[model samples]
Target: MTNTHLPKPEARRQLLLQLLKQHKQLSIHEMTRQMGCSEATVRRDLDLLEQTGEIFRTAGGARYDDPLRGISFHEKEQLFWKEKEAIAAKAASLVQQGDIIGLTGGTTTFLIARALKDRHEITVVTNAVNIAMELAESKKIQVVLTGGVMSNETFELSGPLAEAKLDGLHINKMFIGIDGIHHQNGISTHSELEARMTSIMMSRADRAIAVFDGSKANKSSIFHISPISSLEAIVCNTPLPAELQEACARDNVTLHIADGEPDAL
Candidate 1:
């Protein structure tokens, strides 16, 4: 008889972390091959690991959920920390006492939500579960969530249900984050459903402000969310690329570059 018994769950989890630590990220199929298990078993392990904050699930793989390697939201928050905070502060200053703001999910907007926690008499509508929870302690700031299925990668709610929640509402300002921004390619994101939700927010708001860092400048992503012309303002913590600067000028979009290292230009 052939020996086919698999390792215990705890031992398997330890092995999973070891694999993630070695490879940075691995897909379900890869895990299955390595562990000699079914894809479903791999997925279950990933889910359990994620619940314990041991790993972060990506679009098709799992990463160590570490600040150094994970591309998930938590790991992203550790990258360019100062730049993001500066952008958040500048973005927060633009809000008035009673503005109704719409914030989309991403590290930048998450910081923006935190920056506004002290303000009073403002309404914030968001699709991020983390952002909503961050602002929950503030009695002055009203946080509304778009009801939908939650995304494991972003901890954001999406799909048609979330999109429908924004239809009847009007916003004074919409602060959005993107995966990439280019003069010709326009704004782009990694998720198609998230892109659709962003489009809806842009159309419903009076002023659409993009809050992102310099790394995204001139880069392009898979899903194009909106044209460059859709933005009224952009808050970034790095010097704008010449093309982006010129595009902002030509389009009459106000560009606010936060204070940062000269290289960020």
Candidate 2:
């Protein structure tokens, strides 16, 4: 039972689901080992998981769900720390002094908040309570947290209050994260409130930038915040797939694939 494959689709699916929930991000080798299946079988199962929103495949592994979007900070801390920090550091360089930026919720944005610590005199509005708290101590930067119901699972402020507050403010740029970046639906996430907040923020901004790790590509979600055609740039730590690159080119969106290095900034 330890190293065996559950051949039945229902059995395989159940086992796969259990593993996905238990392991925040399970590597291919790990899946291959525990599931007692061929690499191809594991890949096929992962694809089913991806399609069903039970998991998402990354470069070396697969995360629990579509975005790993609703994870606790403790869970998120386990993945993409260096890469997310570097992504945030690179994202910060895009901010010109005195720019009003709309920020969204997620691990990458948390890193963005930390990177913002050194900057001053920017009006940063966000639905992320963590980001607001992080930037609030800075006397130089004005942090406005939207009034909304807090999501304990994700540490974000979302729902009507958040969207209403964002609808009134027009900013120079907005930085957001995603659960999925599909060619069909563009940027999406699991939470409707969060997704609505994302759309409202982008609508009120001059330019929209979707920030996520390279892991989010080749995925889709139910709630779409904005079409990929609506964004200004995509900032990530890895190169997007050629299809994605070409899609952005067709849409005239700038693709900034940072190599996890701050010197590039």
Candidate 3:
């Protein structure tokens, strides 16, 4: 490909990261061929990404390094993008003016925050650094960021410090993102810290809602957050299994199915 045909620097770098994420590890030759760029350009992109700690430089290539067992936030953002957006929109529709809402870290909740950006007279309580930053510029929404150690993979603040902050606040509603939702295990996540923190947040909220895509249904992760009975409702892209549906009904938990369409920005 010629120079004029090349993507801009930032776009090219983002594409390179996506490529690396999809292929895991790729040599210089492979990346150059895949990216349709010269070897020198691919090398420079790899060097910059490595410097930013986005990838690990190998002998003649780079590999995506995801230290956390769960999928990284960037990777998760790409998976079920439309479904997540739809779930977020459905969750946001439940918000009311002057209501204090809690948001846990995940692509779905992040999109929920975006969906609420233009609304007025609402407050957002969150443990996600990126969500906090996303709402910082909103003139109408009040943001409360909990203090704790931020995870590189999830951008979520957890530990004692974050839990302590939640003690004083009362949330009208909370939209939690979890790795799995099962009939028996209820809801769970990969990180124990996240599970603990999310549980605490749920306790403080009057209504706790789980927001996820279709893939999370009938799945259980390593760390358990709470049982299915604890949730007020669940919003997802597809209908849940019969067992889960029966569980939700027995527990009086409401279920909402999103159309998986893009929310109007």
Candidate 4:
């Protein structure tokens, strides 16, 4: 039997997605029973999940549709959004005028781009098309976009062309967003090409900081970017685990925790 405790709307939808993944498909009655919610609530959740392209609605049920690449940018933008905004605010506070900043692609870093949009005399060097577009109209902030094929999943430019562009330029700071961060394996992402591009960005920057929410803590993805010791600092919404905290301290990595309430930038 499923747990009787009710979850919030977001939590319930996530749980429903997990159930669909395990069963592949599920009838309304089954979901209503397993989720301990009314049939109407189950249907509503299915509709919302379907709209995100994460599931397919059948006549009386739903089926999980695993994304061909990874989660869509639109979908990722919805998850942990407030936390990401808070983290972005904390990151933006570190930027100084005239700083040439490097940004990697992900929802958090995208928010960082948005946070820095109104700043003056700063140049944003990025591989994410979405980020460059976000800062494009800001007359005070110059935007530099790299050249390469873009990833449909991430909208990040990578490969030989992107690497060549970075060879001549330097960044005052680089804020990277990753799929996972582990104390042992360091920071990582799902795509190797994105990882390679992120490493190059790190190498070009005077300071490299990893920005992520608490859920990413202690998790490790498939492609390794750089070790934890390489980071100058980490900005996250929640406190990291003890082991990871110890690792950060040992490596002299500064950990900046953004408060729970997101600040308006």
Candidate 5:
């Protein structure tokens, strides 16, 4: 007897885990189609996985999660490709030749590092493994690494050691990446160690520039990095919320909106 009923809950969840790992993310519709089940069934499966902390749900889909696999840097690099690139371009254009800058870790800042690859005689201090390595091969730029415990998920250095390394250093500009930005709650990132490092970067820079996409606006994350008053300028692909625009104006923060394709991934 060949019974083609839906797989049992345990089997279904295991299958879901494999799907999330294989794709990094999966939407309810896609999962439903793949499993030959209704959307309701897929939702229940996702809910179960999320309860166990095996997945994290975003607005449209679920992201794979575990001790080894957190919010992925690789996934973020491809999430808002054009928007992040545009924001990076705008941020790069703001940098003057020979300026000493600080960059925190994030996919957007990684793009900023790429955008500044050819700039001459610039010194960049960073705690991000990927960003430092990206600029390591450059002849025109000098890269400084903040040695500390590395976060496998983010590929960045953090902790008290990284904070101490920035103690006596000053920057002409600091470009920051945020997991959340709000009109009142301010800028934040998911990890507390990263948030602490970000706050230090803001304090040591003469000008603090925030680089992010539209998706992060009006949201709050687990850890607060800095207040709205810390920003010198903000570069993003979408328009800021009206309240945020007003707040920026009051705080004397310049906002630059770049145009790009909408979020597809």
Candidate 6:
């Protein structure tokens, strides 16, 4: 026994990681029975995986991380331009003139900024470098950049500084971009700091809107930012679930399903 003194939890965790890497997903019940461990132990191990961003926790199992590793602004914009714009359009309609809006980082929020060019008297606050750069040209709206540490991969600013800057402002509406949105997991992002600021922004705003396409729904991500119930609206494409619609109605959150066209909607 080269390492006989090693703790059982450590050995079981390593084994669990190996199985997860091999299968790309593993259920709690299966892992518990196979590892000869308690249910609580298996759950704790899976929770560790979730914290490390190695896997996304689900109802009874975990899903594999994104194949490409992480998301980038250019890649996200290229990946789902139409759906993002449609979702953004729906989100934009929820904002009235003279509103103070808090927009999140990432391409989806950038699309919302682009869609709001014609809207008047709106003061936009954000930590997205790209969105700030884009909105800088808008004479109709005031763009406030929350100063903070920036993520080179996504080109978004997130950190203690951003959070501090955001704490000073109150907004009428907030639009956030989530990595995944499961009915159980709610809103999640890969970056912990991004999640923190997003949660703060939601709390600071009068109305919170989560904007993402259908691809984001029915999925969970590594870092959970906030619950779905916190938002006042969920904007997405068509074919939404009846259960989700009922849930939103019960939450008093408007669920906008934008198929296409401005007048048709």
Q: State TM-scores per candidate.
A: 0.72, 0.81, 0.73, 0.77, 0.76, 0.72
CA lDDT, every model vs. true structure: 0.83, 0.80, 0.87, 0.87, 0.83, 0.77
- After superposing candidate 2 on the true structure, give the runs of residues whose Cα lies further than 4 Å from its correct spot: 1-34, 38-53, 57-63, 66-69, 260-265
Better of 2 and 3 by lDDT: 3
Cα deviation in Å at residue 60, candidate 6? 30
* Clashes per candidate (backbone, < 3 Å): 0, 0, 0, 0, 0, 0
Q: lDDT of model 1 at residue 159?
A: 89
- Which scores higher on TM-score, 3 or 5? 5
Provide the lowest-lDDT 10-residue window in model 1: 256-265
Q: Write the per-residue lDDT of candidate 2 for residues 1-265, one digit (tens) a residue.
A: 3324555865786787788788777888998899888888888877777766667667778877744355676676667678887788788888877898888988888888888888978889888888888887898998888999998877888777777777668789899988778776788888888888888888888999888886678577778788889998889888887878888989998877666444321
Please provide the root mean square deviation of candidate 2 (C-alpha atoms, Å): 4.5
**Pick by lDDT: 3 or 6, better one:** 3
Model 6, range 117-178, lDDT digits (tens) per residue? 77788999988888888888788999998888988777778787888887768988889988
Better of 3 and 6 by TM-score: 3
Cα deviation at 228, candidate 3, in Å, is 0.4
Candidate 1 lDDT by residue in tens digits, 1-265: 2223655886787787889988988988898999898888888888777655456566577876453331479778766778899999889888888899999999999999999999999999999999999999999998889999998878889988998898899899999998778888889887888888999988989999998887678767678998889999899988788998888889998888776322210
Clashes of 6: 0
Candidate 4 backbone overlaps, count: 0
For candidate 5, which ten residues in a row score worst on lDDT? 256-265
* lDDT of each residue in 24-103, candidate 5, tens digit only: 78888888888788888888888777655456676577887543434769867767788889998888888888799899
Give candidate 3 regions above 4 Å deviation.
Answer: 1-68, 260-265
